[model samples]
Target: MNKNKNQYINREISWLSFNERVLQETADVNVPLIERMRFLGIFSNNLDEFFKVRYATVKRIVDAGKTGKSVLGGEKAKDILEEITTIVIKQQSKSLEILGAIEKELETENIFIIDENEVTDTQAVFLKSYFMQKVSPGLLTIILNDLREFPLLKDTAAYLAVKMVLINEVDGNENKENKYALIEIPKDIDRFVVLPNEGDKNYIILLDDLIRYSLRHIFTMFTFESISAHMIKITRDAELDMDNDLSKSFIEKISSSVEHRKISDPVRFVYDKNIADDTLSFLMDKMGIEETDSKIPGGKYHNRRDYMKFPSLGRKDLMYSKIDPLPVKDFSFEGSILEQIAQKDYLQYTPYHSFSYITKFLREAALDPQVRTIKLTVYRLASNSQVASSLINAAKNGKQVTVQIELQARFDEQANIEYAEQMQAEGVKLIFGVPGLKVHSKICVIEREENDKIKRYGFISTGNFNESTAKIYTDYTLFTAYSPLLKELNKVFDFFETTYKINKYKHLVVSPHYTKNVFIGLIDQEIKNAREGKDAFIKIKMNSFTSYKMVDKLYEASNAGVKIQLIVRGICCLVPGVKGMSENIEAISVVDKFLEHTRVFIFGNNGNSKVYISSADWMTRNLDFRVEVGCPIYDEDIKQELVDTFEISWNDNVKARMFSEQQDNAYRKNDKPKLRSQFAVYEYYQKKLNA
Candidate 1:
């Protein structure tokens, strides 16, 4: 199957297809009812990103004609744009069908999503009270007829496009023209307006319903014969451009870019186009949204991501019960984490195990009198980050804290900038990233003065050190005080200070130079073993596997009879399980309660196995452009744990989707016992803790 004439599927188009798989989750009847609703939230969130980034890029391409092809990865910008619109239209239709199915299922459970018209007398009174007390204060209604200048609509916020027919004559049949107005749904208020329950039946009203109920009050001055409203939302370009002005601080440049993002041109204009032409035209004309923008026909409600926080209504049956994170077996809270690392390396499996170990280690470092210096890289951090707090504490206690915080972590520019400022004010030395490269590596090194020598203790991770995200994002954190590894890591920090001076690494695989070659060499080793008739295999679990070079290499290894298994959670361009080409290759994607965010690679070299946990996926950008780190799991126990996790995921028959070129998103089938990897992973860690 030569898909090469297609060269490569447009990244944006492929991303939309990936989202279609998510939408499939909502449509799948096998999925639990409440979980299906949450899938809707995931779908909405995905579309918001599609518009902000992918669609925005396409829009830029369409505007810039010929030059757009290079940016779009071999596809013409216009061709990609047309393809995305067609695909999105189909996906939207599918979404509606999914919603209809979900609504029907909700009815079976006695959970009715009541609209404004369906509300009874008692419910209306409660809803009215809710409107007054909760939503009214935050509502911004723009009188379209009166305003001199059009209001600048905030991207991602839903607005009600209102049409009112003024009662001009006594006769009800008199020809009266309609007036248009706009009301932005207050994002601060809960989108779900829970109504009083009637015995066993649960009732809920959407925030849109409340707004629909209170529409007359919003426009009391203008008399109308008839009124109608529909939800509309616009998504704008989110790409930030860095200024080359050396005088301005990095934080200032990011802040300015964020401000610029607010007024960025609309990429997609999604509306309940059941709206009258006059109303649509009035809003479109005022918003300056032209035909070039992708105008999508959508349902009455937009921004369904609000449903992610959908109130459980104390219904325990409707929600997944919280799983308590188990403690890591080898690493304990009693003694110094550094001391344990000093003896041998340890692995931390987050979400399955408490992420507090990372925090505790840093806190220990901050308090340890012998510790003189600490260095780390920050990409995306939590709002109230314990990592930042710990680093600041270290700086306060006379420890030299060096942080290379990336100011351009997408959607997190403002947060990282704020963090950089806070860390700088606390006397923590800040490196505003290498001139052009984004520091995507997650590494921390603490230098402790012990026995007349400085010994380094730190952890390298495949995920960020954000505690809040650690609860839901499955990631690996490798803790080690191995002198060789630490020395190489210290060199990585030094490279950030001195970008022109590139250093060779012996242990750790540093990206932008060594990562690609190192990975290729390892894969070649497996291939060589397969050629020699030795037991050879490769297992990788990553967020995405889109690099063509890596794909081709894997394909070659597969043809050579090397067993290849991949558990990619998102974006897999390489189709697995073809007859001759990839008969030895198998790929599955697991999407469950926790996001499978960890990147693990296992290579079988003869009888010995080498496992690695990396911050980078097998993506070209990660390998060639970004500063990523892939560290070997030298600790035997940790390597075994990673192997076990990969196996558990590989064995997953439930919640694992088979990835094919067909894009069916079919569930992996097996006669074996049901295995959901996320659940199995948790159980495995729990058992480890108990043992």
Candidate 2:
């Protein structure tokens, strides 16, 4: 129990710790071989984003000559940046070792990941043809030495820095000259090139090595003594810089900013460790990368994120068994989904339950003649979104469709903008949210005319409405016909249009106005109950908890003897289990097959517990800057179900890692029987369906 004077951990450091937990999955033997590789990919992908956003923010602070202690959790910005770089270098080194181990284990399963030099003559014949046909046309090779201006490297794309020692015959005098070139890895082509199978064994080579082997063909015009290529990538600042131009629309501004991100300041520069020093220095100098920038030395591969799409190779035995998304216990798609909701509120826990219910609800509203209006919020959508199509369908019908599509949903901004344009063109009224606030709440309300009375039905969720993410992100979506709650939900959309008028919510907790106050009031009640010895406890599950004010209030409650349990998946700043500070609070994080994205809060109010599912984490932006919504579970059955699920997650002994003052991600173990919460949760739903 190492204790520090600081009450909260630095949010950036805590995020790195969370990613370390993801990296741990790559080394866990219980994880399937291919899945372990994919976990490595996930770790790498998470790091790339961290540098692009979080690391870049600290860099800006340092550049601005500000200490940034208040905003950065009592640490100076420069010191935090140095600590981050040190941690990332070590994590990158460990990930390479884990990758090597996974590759060895993959060999045991009759799968081989070989390099270019290891390619057989038979494979070489196939590789040459493959490169000439599929890889040659898309390749963009730039000769750097002769160009007056350096090319602008795309932040998302990795490149092969090629160094060739050429024999330049000037007037019959053979002079040795160094020629440098960069070959952009084609994003259109697959990174993993599967060779023809030899008997029962499978073989795959990365696209980088394939291009390495065919370099002579690409530069036939140059007479070179030797040639070599190594991977290099740059991650630029991804913060969208919006220009103040009243002439342009919001979508146009976002589109321009996204385009500008291609050449923004580089926050990170990653190169293969095997690359020559001169080549590394040359690329850095040409790209104007400073020594102060985060330069990470990686393995032969740069974008291991491509491993996330590593070919399945039709090997089911080497992968975890996929489970069929279950149906909600008593809810059915056979009849109208809206009608079923009118009876009692039901919860749809996705990745365990089918996401089809959401689509079905929208589809029904589109076709139902009695429905007069459909209103929803869009954050991120799938490539071909059935949700957007259903909204368009509703508009095509007589129903008035209103969608508050957020154009600033980070990395998915372009996709959201496209959907907004298409929806707007199709007669769906579009609201781009409030000027400063991002509409992150996942709520939809519909008005239906039943016997001359307009009845409201809607759902509030703790995750995005994207179909693709719903399959992997564990979220809670509550379907209800409760008029009071739905009416408040409508007020959220109303606030989007009329920004000056602040609306009051009795049934729903809306952010940017009342989320922090409401939550603090709940914590205060728990503290009072603890003082009176009335079974006081608070259980919260969220993706992140970084608000220092909320953290201090929880610490105050902990001192008052209120038992608090937190299951935060990432970026938790509060230090739990500290004597005289937070001895009564215990926190754990779960990183497993599915992402823990649901935000649930349960307060024991003297036998009458209060429960809520929200889109907001306990972060500053969520509490003060964004428009988020938290909905109460009024139905007894559904409230009990939420409690049951949270208990199961809290009881997880396998995947759960305790949060401590030391910041070590040690797994929670005990004498109790092993319960992997993810697996147990699916089983729990199965039992409910059977019972």
Candidate 3:
């Protein structure tokens, strides 16, 4: 590795380190027992996707016989694959240990997760009946011993690989045969099978165990001497390969790509290492997998992602209490949202604040008699999205409604395609996307008849408008009536419709056109201020930072004696605290109860600061390749709130880890009292509601 290589951490490795911080949360004793278990689920879920997308990409590069060192940030694709396997093994072992600790704690709380071996008579009866009623119908089983072809395994679904030691009786009239089979756990059913409580003791069994209990019934005809079962999982490449055929519609292209992804070549295979050697060999041979494939040896259970749906079982103390989403204090729907927007800008912080205000704004425009046109861009939406419904309703009423739906939003293609078709059917003008750019900007604009002239009002956000996700994913939506900015926003929509022309943005920072220049100009401002002996500093919080141009710009600012603080949640490439290099820059990553997702960029422009919440990060994909927006926080109160939130996150002692080249994930050490930022953020919003 060279100096520049040492200056930056590998993006994929940095991402795994970020997930390791999540795993740390599960092992953290301070967290509530059940919540820690949920953290394990989160860690597992994060790992699954990392393999599906990131790891799978590396494997492809390796398969194509490319070293891929430059793209992988100084690590060869093959080397990164081996590193991922090793790190994942360590993390998996840690997770098992954490699960054991959590189970011990649960027992202390009179809640037990019993397995097949530990199931009581009553629990067994309950599981048997449940299996017959619910699980049996959905169970897809195959006799592996006799089949000419091994069954294709679905990615993300866990399966039980059974090895049946059938006793072949030499009966003169009976034909005997050995048997082995596989039973896939149904994704439609709940993973946690809760049983009838016995006096204060609440018992839970995994769906896996319940299946184990019903194995005899599944293979009754075969007289098995003994049976052993273990779990196995696989993750495949998720990159969609779109056909360049002009005859195919965008929706058809997306449909075909989504279908193709299901059968994409496997990137990672995880199985119980304790599995019988014969059984393991049989599986490897049937699946046509070679020893060169990433065959990871794991423990008995896989697909811990199912724990995301772990039942509450009315155990109120075991889970975090639901924090009711607060209303945007001054913004209301009784009157025209446009009128309120015409006066000043507003910020809507989600989960801690209601997302309904966004829907309500669109709904009002859709129903209002005075509204003329509505235009917006959608990256992702809830399953039964009211946002899409309102747009459809607007179209039905003969109002102009335009939606630029991003069909390339990773893993959400089918949903976006479905919404696109539904909106098109309702007469809404649908923009597939900019020819080469994914429209990731969360923006909405409404034009209405007021004062005998057309007026504009709307908002921009740093995340998707999906209502279900809004409750968990922290994001910021800015509602504004600034005409200059609104006019530029309108121009952005026009640019989407006419991709051949690019419009100049004066106020709003738009990507693939102006974002990089604007950001670099802002950094130069800080560098100039530092040279002038003025107060110069920059504070930024984003999900990921991987753009080499931006990183070099930050380095220039740092070398010019400007202070930089970063609170990144994932994939940070910039190294801090290096002598004469990034000594002025301090970077920390905060991983806690709530996902630190909202992207906030605060530039110390000689103390006359400019703050922006953007849907785009500093990554190359977000800057030059996607249609993303970064809206300035014009509301004084909202700007101060953003500053305070950033400060609080920077002050996090608990759940905050230093981003360093060592990848140690060391918790930020401080003499100050413990402050978990997410909990504090919730209280901060709560106090605002009380005030």
TM-score of each: 0.95, 0.99, 0.97
lDDT per model vs. reference: 0.85, 0.94, 0.87
Candidate 2 on 286-367: residue-level lDDT in tens? 8888888889999999988888988899998878899899999989979889889999999999999999999999999999
lDDT of 3 by residue, 1-43 (tens): 1145477788888999999999898888787677888888899
Residue clash pairs of candidate 3: none
Task: Report the candidate with higher lDDT, 2 versus 3.
Answer: 2
Worst 10 residues of 1 by lDDT: 1-10
Candidate 1 vs candidate 3: the TM-score winner is 3
Ranking by TM-score: 2, 3, 1
State the TM-score for model 3: 0.97
Better of 1 and 2 by lDDT: 2
lDDT of 1 by residue, 1-691 (tens): 3344443445676677678778877877766678789888998898898889878877776797565766566677888888888888888887887888888888888889989889899887888788888888878887687788888888968889888998776556656777777888887777887788899888988988889988988778877889999999889899996678899977888899999999888888899958888788888888788876788888888888886777677766766778888878877799888888788887888898899998999899999999999999999998899989999999999999999998888898889988888999999999988876888999999899999999989889999989999989999998888899999999999999999999999899998999889988999999899999999999999998778788878888888889999988887867677766677888888877788899999999887899999999988889988899999987787788889889998999988888776767788898999988888888887787777
Please give the lDDT score at residue 425 for candidate 2.
93
Per-residue lDDT of 384 in model 2: 97
Model 3 ranges off by over 4 Å? 1-5, 170-178, 689-691
Worst 10 residues of 3 by lDDT: 169-178
